[model samples]
Target: DAGVTQSPTHLIKTRGQQVTLRCSPKSGHDTVSWYQQALGQGPQFIFQYYEEEERQRGNFPDRFSGHQFPNYSSELNVNALLLGDSALYLCASSLGLAGDSYNEQFFGPGTRLTVL
Candidate 1:
């Protein structure tokens, strides 16, 4: 089965410019979660999508949003991005949401976004 995959492995954007990154979940997975990993820090959950609807979210502001397609692929959209948004954006997939034993997530290499 194909594993999770992310596009643009790397990106560069200026402060205040919006960016959209894509993700394709692993085969047979239905849940997709977006995470932001700043240098030296652990991945922080941005939000999660299941069955094409956002099932759970984190402490992120309105500037951060996402969408999951019927195919189980997803996209992370950041609006009015800031310098702080520059980080490695990771996409993870699981059979279900957190707390479920079946939810052991698989992560992609991530898109390294650089905000200038």
Candidate 2:
């Protein structure tokens, strides 16, 4: 089966622009997590979704939003983008909620967003 996958591999937007990135989870996975990775830094958790509801969120501001579809696909939407928003957006798939100890995450190749 195919692992997690992200769309538009790369994107460019001006500051204040809005962008949406998509992800499709691996087979049989029901949860999805989004992360942002800046240059030279490890991925930072953005939010997580399970059963089509956002279950957890990290330190990101309100400008960052997301949704999970019934088919286990997800979309990460960022509004009023800023230069600081430029980063590699990652999507990871797992079998259960973040609280589940047995859940192992499989990450996608990531969508690279550049803000000018």
Candidate 3:
């Protein structure tokens, strides 16, 4: 049984460029959530996907978008990226939307994105 997973463990890009991050949920999980962790700060919620629909989002801007497939995997997209956008993009897998049933969370190591 694999836990959450992320791709392109590391990435480098110039400001104003676009980037896409990928994630696959854990087995038996149907919900996927994304977060951004700055150098020394805690993770900031980006958005969440459930049943192929976006059910929740954080304080991120419109440039940040996401998608969830029927298989429960997800992708995060950042357009017109900024230097500040550089960070560890994390993916978390849960049983369902918050407060649904399961509370335990599974996490991925995260994708490191650097915007120069």
Candidate 4:
């Protein structure tokens, strides 16, 4: 009965450091997607996982990666983080392909990361 959940509500790190954020999907949901939102910009898609495999991705670089566990939980990892990477990382889940308006993705509050 819970909605999507994310860990480490906020984080702070220096340039070049790596960070991993986590998420747990709502009950009965399977697909998980990640997005990055800058201070004043809309979220940019990171990637998505379904059945433990990455099903879709965005324009992000290879440094952005993720994993989905059997329980429908997921993790988002950023390597060699850059100052520009400082933003709110959001996790979303849906029962089916998120494109369908009927099955719109439910989002989490997001993990805020600050890069110095």
| Most lDDT-accurate candidate | 2
Assess each prediction's global lDDT (C-alpha) against the native.
0.94, 0.96, 0.93, 0.93
Q: Write the per-residue lDDT of candidate 3 for residues 1-116, one digit (tens) a residue.
A: 99899998999999999999999999999989999999999999999899899898899999999999889899999999999999999999989755656577789999999999
Q: Give the per-residue Cα lDDT of candidate 1 at 114.
A: 97
For model 2, residues 29-55, the per-residue Cα lDDT tens digits are: 999999999999999999999999999
The TM-score ranking, best first, is 2, 3, 1, 4
The per-prediction tally of clashing pairs is 0, 0, 0, 0
Give the Å shift of residue 108 in candidate 1: 0.4
Regions of model 1 farther than 4 Å from truth? 97-102
lDDT per residue, candidate 1, 13-71, as tens digits?
99889999999999989999999999999999999999999988999999999999999
Clashing pairs in 4: none
Query: Predictions ranked by lDDT, top down?
Result: 2, 1, 3, 4
lDDT of 4 by residue, 1-116 (tens): 88999999999999999999999998899999999999889999889899999999999999998898989899999999999999999999988665747777899999999999
Q: Which stretches of candidate 4 lie over 4 Å from their true place?
A: 98-102
Candidate 3 ranges with C-alpha deviation above 4 Å: 98-102
Q: What's the residue-level lDDT of 110 in candidate 1?
A: 98
Say which prediction, candidate 1 or candidate 2, comes out ahead on lDDT. Answer: 2
Q: At residue 67, give the lDDT of candidate 4.
A: 90
